[model samples]
Target: MRTRPIGPYGTAVSVIGQGTWQLERADRRTAVRALNTGIDAGMTHIDTAESYGGGAVEQLVGEAVRHRRHEVFLASKVRAANASAHGTVAACDRSLRRVGTDHLDLYLLHWPGGHPLEETLAGLRALHRAGKILHYGVSNFHDRHLAELFARTGPDEIVCDQVLHHLGDCSAELRVAPACLARGIAVVGYSPFGLGSFPPSPRAAAVLDSVARTHGATRHQIALAFLVREPHSFAIPKTATPSRAEENAAAAEITLSDEDIARIAAVCPVPADDGTPSSASGRRP
Candidate 1:
């Protein structure tokens, strides 16, 4: 798999990672096999969340990585509701237990929430100091939220900003991505295929088809390749079967040419933002 520096820590992580958002919908044994398959394919970055399947998926991930944990860069998120100074720590503890790990490679606040950002930071900082988590970041935070965060912390203090970025939704590219890129932060694109809503426009479908043909790849693989084309960007496209996992992992090997990227850009321009959250996946837990 291709690799990129995840944060200021300069940790090299797989450009294409495994996302376990709804793995519970699959049979437990199958889900575990899929994760292992992706890992074996060099997708060493595994992301899970406490909110996903009410923590069942985390346990599933735990079972998958139990023996090969050292080979994986595991990450998990604390729900916004549990992002307070106390709640963040408590939630991480439970997540650690569920994942059967002593420490997380990365931890994140699910999104901006009612709690003061400082409280969330305090908890994350505490975790870092105590060696509970090696790095921390935020998901679904916009440029404005990032500015506020940078006020209290250095740009490097936060490693990445996970957001909704795909062929159709380039809202993050409008501001969030530039802001992060300026600060040497990684832009981790979740739901890179737009939550199974790929080709948000007819023109996009044509562009993807043409590009896929040029590379002898599927449109889905092309979409994943597009998201990680940039040096500072990473993608975590989820799958529940070993076949799909291998297919997703293969995206890291397909490099889009300049003409391919330009064509995609012309056909799927960033849509005008309606002042809504970048993610189509609801932010609230």
Candidate 2:
């Protein structure tokens, strides 16, 4: 797996990571095999959340990596409802327990809910001080949310943001990614396949098929390769099938040329190659 430093703070993760959403909701054996296979294929950064199957997926991740934890960069998240200082602490504690790890490589707030950011960050800092988490970030946050955060804390306090970014959605790139890149924070794209909920349009499908055929890979691999091409961007695609997990890991090896990236971007609505979004300052890292 190709690795990059996720943030200035020094967390190097695989450019193509593993997302374990609902990984253990059905057959426990299959879920464990997928996790293990992905890791074996050099999928080092594994992400999960408290709301993923009521924490069952975290347990599955724990079991899958119990013997090889050092080989993986583990990330987990707490729901927005638990954004309070005490709630955040308690939730992270449970996550650590479920994941069978004393400390998380990265911890995140699942979203910006009604809770006060100060209280939430205080709890996250508490975890950091106690060595329960190395870095803290957020998910599903836009530019305004990032503004609010930078207003209170230094820009570097948050290490990354995880968002739904795929062939059909470039919302994060338009609103969140430039802000993150400016501050030297990484952006991790989850649901690269749209959580199995979104299907590509015919035109987008054709674009992906064309790129995939050129690379001798599946369309899904082409879709994921687009995300990792962006500077300071990573992708974590989740699947409970072992074969699919292996395939997802292989996507990291398919390098798309500038033309392939631009063709996909034209169909996906991401900013033009001239710049990431609005200004020349948003250039890819």
Candidate 3:
């Protein structure tokens, strides 16, 4: 339930945010229950996108947070195909309508393609200037893309980069992490539990199990704790169950020792030729 500052924007988001990609397929009651459970557990950050379930997720979020919008740091992304200035502007308006919000705490470029980097940056800048979005970020970007985007837009405008980072996927450590760290950009790590490929490696599992026993937490909780323990790092693990939501929120209080961190890092997967881990293939988006 603790919060972490998301980049230099001074916005403090929940350490364990809720990703709403899977909520699109859930029925109304189920979706509302899951969202309410997350809020009740002190999870104040939620990530969604306009493309998710053709805007169904955003609509559900709107309904769930009708009277509690101020309690959560809501975030959503614009698809790569809608990367132009015009596209982004219109998309942001549409997102606000769907979510029943006037503004977003963070708005991200869902992918790193489909338009010129400058165009995308310009769109984000316009949104910030218009007060439609508080901060701007990117997802699914590589080192080269990060460099190009930052170079064109300057570092201050780029707040964070959401990427796949977990025990089974630590490829971001090679370049993305260092680049963001040096530039003062926060890293939002998605799929912190490897998207259901839990209990990563024997070494990692052993370390996690030991830490869990010490904290009376679950393996998944220990796994998430490992990510948020890093400076300027955040984790968003999706879940539809109330029990799992509470378990994830409890991880914020589970601090890992230096030895535990080193052990977990040692077993993290290495990057492949594409600069992404092999385990990332298991991720749906």
Return the TM-score for each candidate structure: 0.95, 0.92, 0.92
Scored against the true structure, residue 262 in model 2 reaches a CA lDDT of: 89
Residues 184-261 of candidate 2 have per-residue lDDT tens digits of 889998878774534468788888899889999999888888888876999998888899988999999989998998
Tens digits of per-residue lDDT, candidate 1, 176-243, equal 88888888889998888775577878888988999999999999899889889889999998888899
Which pairs of residues collide in model 3? none
For residues 16-70, what per-residue lDDT tens digits would candidate 3 score against the true structure? 8888876877677776787788888888788999988889889988998999999
| Alpha carbon lDDT at 194, candidate 2 | 71
Question: Evaluated with lDDT, which candidate comes out highest?
Answer: 1
lDDT of 1: 0.89
Candidate 2, RMSD to the unseen true structure: 4.9
Superior candidate under TM-score, 1 versus 3? 1
Error (Å) of candidate 2 at residue 37 is: 0.8
Every candidate's lDDT: 0.89, 0.84, 0.82
* Model 2, TM vs. native: 0.92
lDDT of residue 149 for candidate 2: 84
Off by over 4 Å in 2: 195-199, 271-285
